[model samples]
Target: MSNTQQLKDLTTQVRRDILRMVHKVNSGHPGGSLGCAEFFVSLYSDILDRKEGFDMDGIGEDLFFLSNGHISPVYYSVLARSGYFPVKELSTFRLINSRLQGHPTTHDNLPGIRIASGSLGQGMSVALGAAQTKKLNNDSHLIYSLHGDGELQEGQNWEAIMYAAGNKVDNIISTIDLNGQQIDGSTDTVLPMGSIKGKFEAFGWTVVEINEGNDIDAILKGMAEAKSKTGKGKPVCVLLKTVMGNGVDFMMHTHAWHGKAPNDEQLANGLVQNPETLGDY
Candidate 1:
């Protein structure tokens, strides 16, 4: 299959897995998971090298970190479907003793996940630190990190951002899910991220805005641009404008469903909009 088609198929399977896993556990943040499905698909399909399996230190391989752990559904699903673990393990999500916790953690020794990140705002620093380590070791591999727009409220992120720019941490690419909605309500109502692009630019980092973050083609294009900007002596940040719940209408336009799993009826309805491309996990 072509890279484009493969990414689309991966996204479909990811959406299916997200629904089934969340429905089984009766909890999860499907809204963000759905919103970022295409982004993750493009990352796993077009970027990153995992043929030798993932390592915590990730020597000689690109690394990725999830700052917003509530969206673990998409991360776990992508990792499983991309061959990081047995796809069947998805069924054990959120169950006691399951490595796939409600939030991702390295303690479980999950192959793909490198750090625990439910606290938010910390992953950027972690990614930056990891990138610095790679540079220190003279490794050419890049580091990637994902952050929710709301997570920017944490003071640590700004410190990390400043540190990255000041210290020339150019090998890290940080993408923010700027869906304009968090767990509470509209981002503006909760904490207005006024001129996010300007804020990043002012921080001395190269910034790119992706208006169609939910579309696979657009996501690929945006990520390609992000990759191009890497190693240019400045950190890159892509401000992704995504809908809270992208594929399903009822779940869109609000934050009420941000962390709520769909009931049986809702799951059935959502799955209707997204066909099972690689079979449900």
Candidate 2:
């Protein structure tokens, strides 16, 4: 798993899984999920200091909360492939009574999911709470969370941002997927939040920017730096610049795929681009 090439291959396969998962049910978000493939693969395969099994309270292990839960395709794929569940369970995505809901839910007590997330802007608050809980328990493992750049429009996230800095939640690493696109057109068309790095710095966070987010090697290196910044008296924030629909040419650089699944032809096209690096689920 430490091999960068192996992780990149997994990233390609995760993209295949995202495309196929969304296309199978004609539901779910694919843009952000595709954009975050490298992050998820890099985190689970190379970065996280995790235990061998799943539990609600992840003591002595690093934790991850998907703030933008709509990207459940990537989350679910990585979790299953990483042994949180059977990889074949992915076929049940978005089906009634399935653990893989449109957005991740804990009602099924799905392994590797601590909080239900597609409700944008709440993940930071949840992740911060977990970070603080680790502090209270005298646990040194870091807490990680990902947020959509567009989701920053939510007032609750800003409040959480302020609280994290003010409370000195140094045991957490919050990464913003700065894809600049959301469900409704580009983020600028919706609401422009200027200078994310400046905002985080002004709020007293140590920020790291990963300009090449889709590259697994860059992610591993940048996340390592982010992890090293932990316990240094300030929370770390990684601004990961990514393409909305990264691996698929037709889907790239547009918000149309944000919440839309590819059609049969589009799915075939995307699969061709990604290839089945690791066998399909």
Global lDDT of each model? Answer: 0.88, 0.93
In model 2, pairs of residues that clash are none
- Candidate 1 per-residue lDDT, tens place, 146-244, comes to 999999989999999899999989999899999888878888999887988898899999998799998878877887788899899999999999988
The TM-score between candidate 2 and the true structure equals 0.98
Best by lDDT: 2
Model number with the top TM-score: 2
lDDT score, candidate 1: 0.88
Could you estimate the TM-score for every candidate? 0.97, 0.98
Segments of candidate 1 deviating more than 4 angstroms: none
Give the Cα error of residue 141 in candidate 1, in Å: 1.4
Cα lDDT tens digits for candidate 2, 112-164: 99999877899999999999999999999999999999999999998999999
